[model samples]
Target: MAGGNGLLEVRIAVPAKDASRIARLLVEERLAACAQVVPGMTSTFRWDGEVTTAEEQLILAKTHRSRFEEILDRVGEAHPYETPEIIAVPIVEASAAYAAWLVDEVAAGERP
Candidate 1:
């Protein structure tokens, strides 16, 4: 279900090898309500003077949209990439119960 303005979209990039570990850490730390690891992503980009291609894992994190920057910062701190990609996209739909849980988990650190 749509979570109004409080809904967040958080994305992080990690090395294929460290994707799983970072995903677990983010969930355990409550930085993200949930994280989905997408595998076999091929990224080609210009680095230095030559084009480079690498296999990467894309992590989609669910959280309050307002907290997008915070989530990005956390991911950056934990990420192994010299320049990690952290992006957020608004969530359009989700299960009500799951959405509620996501809010609750994120509010864990806030004053009630």
Candidate 2:
């Protein structure tokens, strides 16, 4: 939903070849604590008054809600699509230890 634990799961759909690069960028930039690339996704959507289907890769990034806008901007610059699918959903529940690790990994002004 809206707010929960200050953590987020950001999803970005990109061409298969660009998945790793985008994931690495987010993690290396410390905007996300972790980025996982899931390949072989088949997506069908309406574009330019036509239905299109394509194979895509999904990048799931774990980060704080505070970093959403920055992630959006960065993905926009690197994404090939005119309108990339970049969305974040709150982490409503998480193990205490894992949550702590995530926060520590992406803490502002700190490198891990």
Candidate 3:
């Protein structure tokens, strides 16, 4: 999702054990300016035509919209699930200072 600020709030759900590693990877690689790993989340969903519930970790990542595809690719490589839950929503509005900081941090690690 794109917006005037060109910022996105990406959400990625992973196994609780892998939460911190994934968050660190994203932030270290600059795929995300910041990543917060929220643990103790219980997710219930359908998989393979059956209902299931599992403990999960939610990683909330803040990044520029342009870095979304890279984030997906990187997460896919690191994630254990066959189809990981990776989604993003546009950050339609943010404080100017925060927006600028986010953009700057992500941009600092831009690929050639």
The local distance difference test score of each candidate is 0.78, 0.90, 0.94
How many backbone collisions does model 3 have?
0
**Model 3 clash pairs?**
none
* Cα-based lDDT at residue 60, candidate 2: 96
Using TM-score as the yardstick, the better of models 1 and 3 is 3
Residue-level lDDT tens digits of model 3 in 1-112 = 2257789999999999999999999999999999999989999999999999999999999999899999999999999999999999999888888888999999998998
Please give the lDDT score at residue 112 for candidate 2: 37
Model 2 pairs in collision:
none
| Predicted candidate 1 versus true structure: per-residue lDDT over 1-112, tens digit per residue | 7546477767776789988888887778777878899998988888788998988989887888656666677777888877888877777777888888988887774433
lDDT of 1: 0.78
TM-score of each: 0.84, 0.92, 0.95
What tens-digit string does per-residue lDDT give for candidate 2 at 1-112?
A: 2246899999999999899999999999889999999989999999999999999999999999878888999899999999999988889888889888888888862433
Model 1 stretches with alpha carbons more than 4 Å out = none
Q: Model 3, residue 105: displacement in angstroms?
A: 0.8
Candidate 1 TM-score, true structure as reference: 0.84
Model 2 has an lDDT value of 0.90
What does the lDDT read for residue 31 in candidate 2?
Answer: 91
Instruction: Give candidate 3 regions above 4 Å deviation.
Output: 1-3
